[model samples]
Target: MAGLKPGAPAPQAITVHGQSRVLEIAFSDGAVFRIPFELMRVYSPSAEVKGHGPGQEVLQTGKREVGLLGLDPVGNYAVQPRFSDGHDSGIFSWDYLYHLGSQQARLWADYERRLAEAGVDRDAPMAAAGGGACGHHH
Candidate 1:
């Protein structure tokens, strides 16, 4: 009866830093995180990014300069981030945001490793031979 009660974590300030290509979020718990747009894009919660299930994840490559186009409220429980890369399906919840912030360094490293293993570059434009499909440029 002396600890914090169960409740939704509140985000004090959420900002899209275009200059730095990062999304800054400050929590009520006094934690502040500057998450790179590229990171969010690669780790997007959208089915397109995460896929319908494991082992089907589409590896997102060449998003080093991604930008945050906008953030919209999704029932006060989460925010939808629209990226300059045209990805806006991920609804980042408060808990997920916190996790991203806390685990950023490690997650990013893993992503880099995966990219290297896949022979991909973070800044190279991604192109695949998919007929009539939108390709990633830059």
Candidate 2:
């Protein structure tokens, strides 16, 4: 299905389902989606995730346990979700959120496949684990 149409009703309520690590949004149209934190992180619209252009997307692994750190509204059109992984650049618009909800299954499958193709060991050290920290005092 297509993304949210122009003039479409925005979410009437939004809740961070921390226990389930999902963000639940009930749109004015009565459509609700439970988006997993992992999905939101990997699919972030930030430059860190999307990169400068095509083929520059950084593969996000080891984020199955990530959580939503916080959220801030952007005008009347979007919200920026700060992730536990220190990612807070993606400004998710209403249309983009709708797109994500509609494409969640396929996008998640692709993310999983890419992780496998990259041979990223899921048990690898997390970024917060001091992975490759130089520890330079400059």
Candidate 3:
């Protein structure tokens, strides 16, 4: 079986604009993006963000002002993002990050639609969904 190769290093530039909740990343590939923190928060690759199975996803709400508290490397393939709200579970792989950078608009729009359907506001205070505030079913 063929194994996956190690991912590339993180972008050289990462700027987070707290006021706008946007996290901008400029990759070596010359791709750049300004992804909203709310968008990142909702679409976090963590199990806490992405449920174990299809249709099991828990909607993330009240995260309009979320920010990245820290970024820690997970070996050579991914980076773990620690959110200011104390969420740190997802290991964002290079591929995942690239996808987010490319599909941000669509993902964000879907997230918003889901939130609306659930009667949740992205800017309100968050309440625990699965277990603890950071617990997710993966």
Candidate 4:
């Protein structure tokens, strides 16, 4: 990973709680967080969701029940999650995960705000497959 931040706390352990729909991660710095699958899906750092530039983020919806089918290691710095919805593009780094864990509350609030602003419900269905911010159309 070219942009891996220096001295970031690496994950010492990561547990996928399918029953609770949470990812329990313990870092080398002794911080533990239970990150929700939905949050990860909504905030996926992939080009699909985040697009290629600022202001192009595609808001994700109907991901409250999304599940992690797999969490695969990417070399030594990041993890790629295979979501139940078949979204496997986001490569979450250690620092990014930490940021998500720490800022979850704020992020949720922001998501809610965006939903309200768009007049869309939190559980609204997402757009059809192949029609996303990934710069590809089918």
What C-alpha lDDT does candidate 3 achieve relative to the native structure?
A: 0.75
List model 1 lDDT by residue over 27-99, tens digit each: 9889999998888888998877775567667778878888888999887668899998788989888888888
Clashes of 3: 0
Clashes of 1: 0
Q: What is residue 102's positional error in candidate 3, in angstroms?
A: 1.0
Q: Is candidate 1 or candidate 4 better by TM-score?
A: 4
Judged by whole-model lDDT over C-alpha atoms, candidate 4 comes out at 0.91
Q: Estimate each model's TM-score.
A: 0.85, 0.82, 0.79, 0.92
Question: What order do you get sorting by TM-score, best first?
Answer: 4, 1, 2, 3
Model 1 stretches with alpha carbons more than 4 Å out: 1-5, 128-138
Model 2 deviation from the true structure expressed as Cα RMSD, one decimal place: 5.4
Rank order by lDDT, top first?
Answer: 4, 1, 2, 3
**Judged by lDDT, which candidate is best?**
4
RMSD of each: 6.2, 5.4, 3.8, 2.1
lDDT string for model 4 (54-107, tens) is: 887888999999999999999889999999999999999999999999999999
Scored by CA lDDT, what does every candidate get? 0.81, 0.80, 0.75, 0.91
Q: Name the weakest run of 10 consecutive residues (lDDT summed) in model 4.
A: 129-138
lDDT accuracy of residue 97 in candidate 2: 78
Q: What is candidate 2's local distance difference test score?
A: 0.80
